[model samples]
Structure formats: structure tokens, C-alpha cells
Target: MRHQPFETWLLFDDPLTPDQARALDEHLRACETCRALGHSWRSVASLFQASPDLEPAPGFANRWKARLVQEDQGVLTARYRWQSWITLILIANGVSLLGMLLGMTFFDTFDSLTEILLVLVYRLTSLLTVINIFQNLLAILIRTIPGLLSPSGWAILALIVSSGSLLWVLSMARLARMPGRA
Candidate 1:
């Protein structure tokens, strides 16, 4: 017959039947190999049962929680440190670039800028010269306008203007009185 299953008898959590125990005992008596294996297995099982279950030290959970909080604070502080440095670096670079641009515009391009400004002023002066000529001619015409008109000519112009205004008022009144006009 094959060797009895000694491992099942030794390692099972529940007690075995009487027939299985008797059969395992008979096999162990006949087979020295199986008997030695069972004895070693029993010793291992007894050692495991004798040892205590794993557990944390006292206040272990509270200490771990405190460590986690410290670690989080460290990470946040590092992140903010880098953020502040980046912002300061960007602002410094921007200010330096603006300063350099102003220096270049005023120092290196000063002569060319002055020439361009002089050209603009010359063009504006020429334009103002033409405007002054037109203004003088308009003044001369305004001064001669009264001399060009006689007393009878002024009277005739006033009469015509009065008649035209009266005609416009009568037309507006007639339109306002018309049906569907309101």
C-alpha cells in the first residue's frame, strides 16, 4: 500500500477520524521515513503554535500618523520654495530685459531716433505753412465780404430768408394735421 498521508493528520485544523489516526499510526510504525517526516512536521507545528502573533509596538499608530503629517509638511514646503524662486526669477528676468531694452533704445539708437524726429518735425512745419496761407486768404475774404454786399443787397437777402422760413413752417404744420401722420 502507498504511504499514509501523515501531513494531513498533522496540519489539519479539525481533528481526524479514529480510522485515519489508526491508519497513520500503522504506517508510521512500518515506515521509518514517514515516521521521521511526521515527527519533524509536529515539531514545526508546535513551534508555530507556541510563538505569539505579530503586532505593532505601543503608540505605533499615533507615531506613524505624526510622521505622515511631518512628511506632508516637508513636501509642501519644498514645493512652495521652488514656486517662490521661479516667480522671483521670472520677475528679475523681466525687469532686466526692460532695463536693457530702454538702455539700447536711448543709447544705441539715439542718433537715428533724433533724425527720424527731425524729419517728422520738418513735414509738420511744411503742413503748418500751407495751413497758414489758407488761413490768411480766408481772413482777407472775410474782411471783404461786407464791402462786397450793398445795403439793398442785404435787404433783399433778409427778405428771401424770412420767406423761406415761413414757407417751411407752413409745410410742417400741414403735414402734422394730415391723417395717419401722427
Candidate 2:
């Protein structure tokens, strides 16, 4: 049987009009499901009414606030790390381009295309060697540094490094924006 108005009337605490009340009564009588639902809803409502209100445990608010602050800090840290990586990548690309341009300028003195290509290959090999050396040094530093520093020490080190990187990025941006640079 269609429950409709009967289920709605049973679930809600609103006083029904005489017509709605008559319809709901007829539905409830015919529909076993609606009758059972109405009974269950009443039981639930009574349980809710009888349940006592209780206060939160002590320090709950303070702990919740601390958690929120820690979460915010984590988000900020992640953002900063992402931005730092992007800045580092941009800086590396800029340096590589500048190096290539300088290499091309130097190769301009050469008479033949073969000599230019040879010089370019030699410069690329030298650059790769330097990069490999730096990568090895970075790997060694990563392995060694964590054991040497406490959490606070690491934080301080991070702050110093980030500040330096920020200053460098800002300076580079300012220089790029300058009107007179060729």
C-alpha cells in the first residue's frame, strides 16, 4: 500500500488538519509497513527526549584548537615547499639558458658548424659532470644532516633556507622587472 501522507504525518510532530488526519489513519490501518515505521519513530523520539545532556571532557576545546593550528601550519608548510621547488626549477632553467647563450656567443668565433657543434657537446659534457657532482654532494648531505639536527634545529634550518630563497627570488624578480636591463 502507498504510505505517503501516513509516513510523513507519523515522522513529523506537526498537528494535522482533519482531512490529513483521516487520510493518514486510513493509510496506517491498511499498511503494516507504515504502522511499524510510525511505532519505531515514536520509540526513537521517546529515547531522544529521555537522554540526558552531557558536557564535553575537560581540555577538549584546547586540544581541538591546537589540532586546528597544527593542521593550518602543515598546509602552509606544504604550500611553501611547493613554491620553493617551483622557484628552484625556474632558477635552474634560467641559469641553463644563460649558460647556453654564453656558450653560443663564445662559439661565434668558430669558422665551421662542426667546430660549433664540438664546442657545444664539450660544454654540455662539462655541465653534466658539474650537475652529477652536485647531486652526489646533495645525496651525502641528505644522509648526514638529519641525524645531526633535532626537530627544532631542522625547523630553524628550514626557516633560514626559506628566508634566503625568498630574498633571492624577490631580488631576481626585481631585477627582471627593472626598465634598463637588456
The lDDT of each candidate is 0.87, 0.91
Candidate 2 overall Cα lDDT vs. reference?
Answer: 0.91
Tens-digit lDDT string for candidate 1 (1-182)? 46536766755677879998888788778888777877888899899999998999899999999999999989989999999999999999999999999988767654777787887899999999999999999999999988988999999999999999999999999999999764
Off by over 4 Å in 1: 53-62, 81-182
lDDT of 2 by residue, 1-182 (tens): 56776777888879999999888888888889998998888899899999999999899999999999999989989999999999999999999999999988887789898988998899999999999999999999999988998999999999999999999999999999999773
Which residue pairs show collisions in model 2?
A: none
Residue 107's lDDT within candidate 1 is 70
Checking candidate 1 for backbone clashes, the offending pairs are: none
RMSD of candidate 2 to true structure, Å: 18.5
